[model samples]
Target chain A: MVQINFAKREINCKLVYYGPGLSGKTTNLEVVHKKAPASKKGELTSIATEGDRTLFFDYMPLELGKVGGMNTKFQLYTVPGQVYYNATRKLVLQGADGVVFVADSQPDKMDENLESFQNLEENLREQGLDPKTIPMVLQWNKRDLPNVLTPEELDAKMNKYGAPTFEAVAVTGDGVFPTLKKLAQIVLEKLNREYGLQNDGPGGGSAPAKEPPKEKEPAKAPAAATPPPKKPAAEPPPAKEPVREPAKAKAQDDRAERERAERERERERERAEREREREKDRERDREKEARPKPRDFNVTPPAQEPAKKGGGKGVLLLLLLIAVIGGAVGAGFAGKLGPLQKHYDDHLRQHLGGGTPAGQ
Target chain B: MAMKPSDTDQKLRKQRLIFYEDDIGRINKALENYQNLSKSRCNMLIDVEGHPVTQVGSTEGINLETIAALVAASFAATKEVAKILGETEFSSLTHQGKNESIQLSIVGDRTILTTIFDSQDTTVGMVMFYTKELVEKLNAIFNEIKSRKDSGKPIFNDDFKDMSGVLDDMFGDV
Candidate 1:
């Protein structure tokens, strides 16, 4: 989850490092903490056992000085990669906006890498996110070790999502910053798309100018409508010799015209009222759909929420049925409606039951 | 490349705490009042994920960012311990030291309140009482923030090309 604090003009994003035991997940963070400028980094906090293995997690926060007028900060965390600490791993992965999977490249650690990858996918699914769609990067750490798996082999075996991959020796800071920078770029891109943020050029601090004009356009429409009648009334009177009958006729014409304009305005007001009611109904529906569902927190594992998919298929099927009906009527096949209706019903049932529909 | 609308919509549904100017003002005011009444050394607010929200008091020697992270993790670990003991949770945790002590209490569903005070300056009873009262006030403020309709707008533009340069400047020297 991204925290945008308008009060302080700050934006915070969480990024997590995940991998198997002894995979240098912590080493990557340690290297970055050491190399990053003192002004831009915080103290590295680690909760480790007596043997120096991480017991809980290691965290370091980095400050990326003002980006587009907001103080952007990234909180980097490394989950304990030991197998039994999966509960802690799930906790750390809770609100992660992006993930960096640091895979140990040694050939002997292949099984561990695969297991950890599966675990990552399972945890992400439990959080109601698609593993394939989330912003992610892969780092093949321990590249300096002899007899390590080649990048080609690792990509073929463990790069299931085709995420950007880096070869790094985290102990020496090789390829570490590049991996982090790539992850940040993709994460920012995702944020920009989600929030509909426009690029106002480099270092520009101007507020979004698109939304205000859209709102003003609707308000101006009514104001513009009221002024047209006033303009006609303000025009100069005809400069000619006055005849009583012609002047009386002109007065009657003006009265009838005024009544017609008044009736038009009344109809427009009714239409506007109806539009507002429809908008309110739509808003209510949206709120109901968006309301979060309550969950029992005591359960050892996080509750799984069903993935939302197949929404567009229903609308597509409805359109296809309408098109088929129109074509049938054009061919003068109205008498054959019974068979067509039966076929459509069968197709709909098959599609809903997870079977391929006949036509498609 | 363009993203799918459904994907963007799913991303938008994630739980996020957006603090507007008014929301931060109220939170800071509440924290200040708690400090005055409790007479503690200092206090801080952090989310369940260990991100610092705000802090108030004499935080001269303390590393607040580090403390916030540790406190959040400890609170979570304690929650697990509570489950093992057949309880819903232990809402408040206290660590008593020889000269200084700390108190952590869950303010609302999403945030925790932590206060550090010298053992000699205040008793556990006083700190606990003040903590309870402060938690109630903080909870109301959080509820109001959550119900606000116009939280705020995104501050960043789409161009992220400059980020690589910024990272280089910070890390390249080292």
Candidate 2:
């Protein structure tokens, strides 16, 4: 979870990249690590086994300095790029303030990408995060491959959520930082709105950028909103115009006559406001009362099924077993076919298989 | 080491006349062995077409036609159980109650035996044990028949001559 200080007016947030194995998730992070402003990012730490690769990195914007007023920091993480280690992937994704899905652009890997996305949703559901409301960005990676699907095709396949999608060449740092910046901006906005919640004290609850202190000072001044016109036949707009001033002297006169007329006008207005507010409050209360009593009504959302929860670990375990078993089965097949001396022949075949001869 | 009888091994020669009758002796022996576990007269006669193989326990109070029907029903129930267990090797099925009843089994092909028990005495341990031994004996009988067929001989090779007496003794009360 990211914490923000209203006193310092700053916000912090985390963005994680989630995707399938070999879908260039780690590559996207590598590209960002190489290209981010050197002053602001930390070192990349990788924990890899013979079977999997993990990505861990951070991005701090010195230029954008403080959000509100605290140092704006964006910590980026890439989930492991292997099917088997989904337990670790889910752990990395806990408290994910935001997500960027680095989707592989290969046509054959399309289904794999989609399945991984579904796994992400399932994991998030297990974690109690609604994927739709979570700020998400999609980076369609590996644009350099010739056989890769076109941008339109990939978008049609993966960008159904209307998440900001980017065409990325991670090897050369093409769309890396741009994607990061866009997602970072979104994360920042989400953080502000969330932290800006605390700033919702008395009075209107407009946001920081929308209503600065100087703008609302007059509304807060409480200098008895001036006396009404003695000629009570006057129109409402011009009649209340004196109270709208910020002038110092008028501020004083407005205070005196304002105190007397203000009480009367305040009574009438408060009574009117009270009537309207009370009516609204009762309507709101009645609506609330009616709403909760007939909660079985389809219009009222039913109690959510307490999450049928499990980590990606089961599917991950199955996939891992399948991978090892498949590999063993393949090796057994090859050994049975060619005996112990087959590696030399296989290497030769690999070398001779894809010789570059130009043709259409 | 042990010789066991299997009725399904081969058909017995039809006895035109009986030199002697052991029907009472066999019925007495059956009742002595299984007085506690047996079905009601109504449930035992579950099938109309099946022959009244036997009514094993002391069902003396029930009339002859009812006994015949109950015996046939017992066979049909055993056969149905055989069908359910899939291999036709179904040894036995028994329903149990506490107070009093009758249970029976029909041996088939001598390779498989179908046993059915419907009774208030729900204790089925003895029924299952006896049924398994019976099926094993039946298997040996079928195995002998198979080997005999392999050796290419007529089935009435004198080894099965005594079956007529056994069969007579098994159902002669009718």
Candidate 3:
């Protein structure tokens, strides 16, 4: 999921494009990269195998500019779409914020499409994400293909989950931006629902009135958003004459500048302190590097010389003491910890980390 | 009154992971070389198979059996509070003894901030308060490490394995 930082006014999220091999998953990403301005897209990484188009995965970080005054970014990724790459695909799906399933719409790729959907379900299950609940949209790609399955048939099969579906010819960028925009908007809506980010949308949408948090206000107030039922405007206190603050506003501006300068000074002070700390850290590290080294720590040098001399008389007694006393101490500590341990075991038995009653 | 944790907090309980065993060790080593901790011991960062991911500390050769139990308890108690208040992660867990104590704080979903203390030297409350701040710093370190790992940027060696879920349904309901 995405999190919006209100104070910094930025939204961070991860969006992954998933599908089977040769489905234009990478093609979709490449199209976005080529179209987006250089400043908006990060360098793309593609790992292609000798025989396959995509070997591992491709990752591109795209800055989706700012939405509602918060900087928006989407890190788009494509899993290597081979049957054998399920392990890597599962890893990449570990923390998906939003998913775009780019299915090849060509008639011959129908079986591949179905298999990929199953794989997606299995991966989502492994990651504990309910496919029904994860923010997702489906994109049927290669729509321009004459032999491609009709949208109705494809939706009936693949988009049966009722996720928002889009048709795209990713090669020529048809329906690409619209798909991205829709998914991005869905991602933002989910973020809003999750984090209460009630900011207006990108097109200057009016802010929705916030529902007051259910706190300790009593029954005297009606629950509706209506104004107070009665107004107590009977007070007759005369209004004070309008105060002219133009002269004072100048002083206020000066104070504001002073505050800004003070903040800058404080920042500089902090930087200097950090530099000093770094220097000291370096000096201390150098000293540690140059310091005299201690002799053997864990090694006992095969217990030679003086140890053998003492072994004749005292060694037997020492060994006996160690064995008997050590055993008793260990047992006592174990017993003391047993009650708490049992309580934990009971809980573990109930939870059954190894999964039972249907978990695989 | 306690602050209400959001549902987003619950995600941290389930899906959050903060891993930095190597970075933590390097930090602890610098502290040890500087004699910051009197015991020259590092508390458990990740309670792995037999030993804690530790570099310095008096908990040398501590049995993993107890720590594993403790980690489970810590998560259970936190989960209870989290589920009740809609929070996902916990601030910290502290246990006091006659002359020692151990504090566990959530640094990241994956990583924990642990502090071992002596009653003769430090108060439990003091350790709790300070460890909270320390865990905040560790949280940043965890985030940095995670982002670096995610971006395919190479850093210090990272050893993350596909471990099973930390808790399960068979575990008693909190």
Candidate 4:
């Protein structure tokens, strides 16, 4: 999810790097963290095992200081890629604005790469996210490996959506920024398409409508391959000059003036409504404070009380019991209940205990 | 199970959070008051999905962004744990440390209020007392913000081509 805060003048987006184990998912983050300017990058935090494999996730916050007058921050995360950590991966994938799939280029890792990609799709579906619609890029990592598969073979097997793919050696930082840049670009473009000034409607409700057209004009230049200089000088002044006849130009100007005045009136009305709402809120707060109410430190909020009041607990207990019995029966049928169940229980306990407290 | 179209749309809408200047001002004011009353070192309001909304107090040595992500993940994992334990969910969680402790409480349906305070300065009881009151106020504010039909105009222009330059500036020669 993208968060836009007008008061703070900040925009925050979450981008997740996902792939199979040992595929350089964390390496990409490490390279970005090491190479990114000190002022722009936060400390990279990783929850890993003694073997240095990710156990939960790796997180790093990148601040793009200010872009187009808004403080843009990207929180980069990499999920534990081993198959047993599916739960952790799903948790990390929740509310991701974009994703970067880092696939290993080794021929032997192809099966693992394909399996991880499928797992990513399944998780996206579970979260009600369309894998096709979400902004994503594929990075074929470890290109420097001696027996690496070619990019075309990797793409044929994995790029089902045909997303923008990059070839990279993440350990040495070959194409990390390009991959990240492409993903960020598409993500920002998606955000702009969804919430840009064009959605403000035909009334020209705000001043932003007038500026986007001018900024968009240079995007249509013939030399699109060349980077468009962001200077007012680049915009042709004569094109905007009044070329219409005096009568028509004057009439259009008059209509524009009326629209401007109408917008101002609308703004004033909104301001007045906001003032009323603020006052109402203040009054409610005062009333709440004045009223005598008993507080229970252990009790949940009123909104959550109904769930507890209902027979939800009983049903959940029944379900848990059934699950335990079913697990025991199945394990007995397999004739390896003891060792497998013990390993499963130990793994569950370790993840549950160590994964939650991400504080120092 | 596959989600219905309407359900998916509603879920997506819930995922996005846009804060106008007015909402930000009110939320910040409330957070500042909570921080003062609770005597906490820092207070952060983060969405259930882990995006940091706002914060107050001194966060000089902390990696708040990391904390926000981890806290949300922890809360989510705990929700799953509660389900396994025959409970609906845990509304609040506290982690006690030798010197510094943290409290995380759910606010409204979509956000969490995380307070990191000195264990010696204030007791958990005091923090929980103030949190109960602040949560109600925040819920009301969030409901009002949600009910708003017109939340001003969009500030971002349609031109995203300049993002390349922005990226280059941030990650030079990397």
Measured by DockQ, the strongest candidate is 4
lDDT by residue (tens digit), candidate 2, B16-117: 011101322233233323322221122221112221222333233544333332343344445555667785633344445554434444443311122333
- Give the docking tier of candidate 4: incorrect
Instruction: Quote the lDDT for A221 in model 3.
Output: 20
Between candidates 1 and 3, the one scoring higher on DockQ is 1
lDDT for each residue of candidate 1 in A84-197, tens digit (9 for 90 to 100): 999888878877878989999999999999999999999988877677767787888898899999888888899877776777889988867767766675666566544432
Worst 10 residues of 3 chain A by lDDT: A228-237
**In candidate 1 chain B, where is summed lDDT lowest over 10 consecutive residues?**
B150-159
Better of 2 and 4 by TM-score: 4
**Which lDDT tens digits does candidate 2 get at residues A1-360?**
343322122233557888888777777777766655666565554555545455322222222343322345555667775677676566566556678898888899999899888888888767666676566777788888989997778777776666666777877867666566555555554433332332333433332221111111111122122111111111121222222233653665466455546544644564475457545655654554454332233223323222213466455445544654575566555534332135334434655886431110
- Model 1 achieves a DockQ score of 0.11
Model 2 residue A174 lDDT score: 71
The candidate that wins on lDDT is 4
Q: Which stretches of candidate 4 lie over 4 Å from their true place?
A: A197-360, B1-14, B150-152, B158-161, B172-174
Per-residue CA lDDT of model 4 for A250-313, tens digit only, reads 7865875585466446545754765675566566556645644333311424554555556767
Question: Lowest summed-lDDT stretch of 10 residues in model 4 chain B?
Answer: B1-10
True contacts kept of each: 0.29, 0.00, 0.00, 0.35
lDDT per residue, candidate 4, B1-174, as tens digits?
111224443466555787865686688778877775665778899987777898866676888888998999899899889889999889999999998999999987779999998764567877897788789889999988778664324435323446666876875423
lDDT of each: 0.69, 0.46, 0.53, 0.72
- The candidates' interface RMSDs, in order, read 22.4, 52.6, 24.0, 13.0
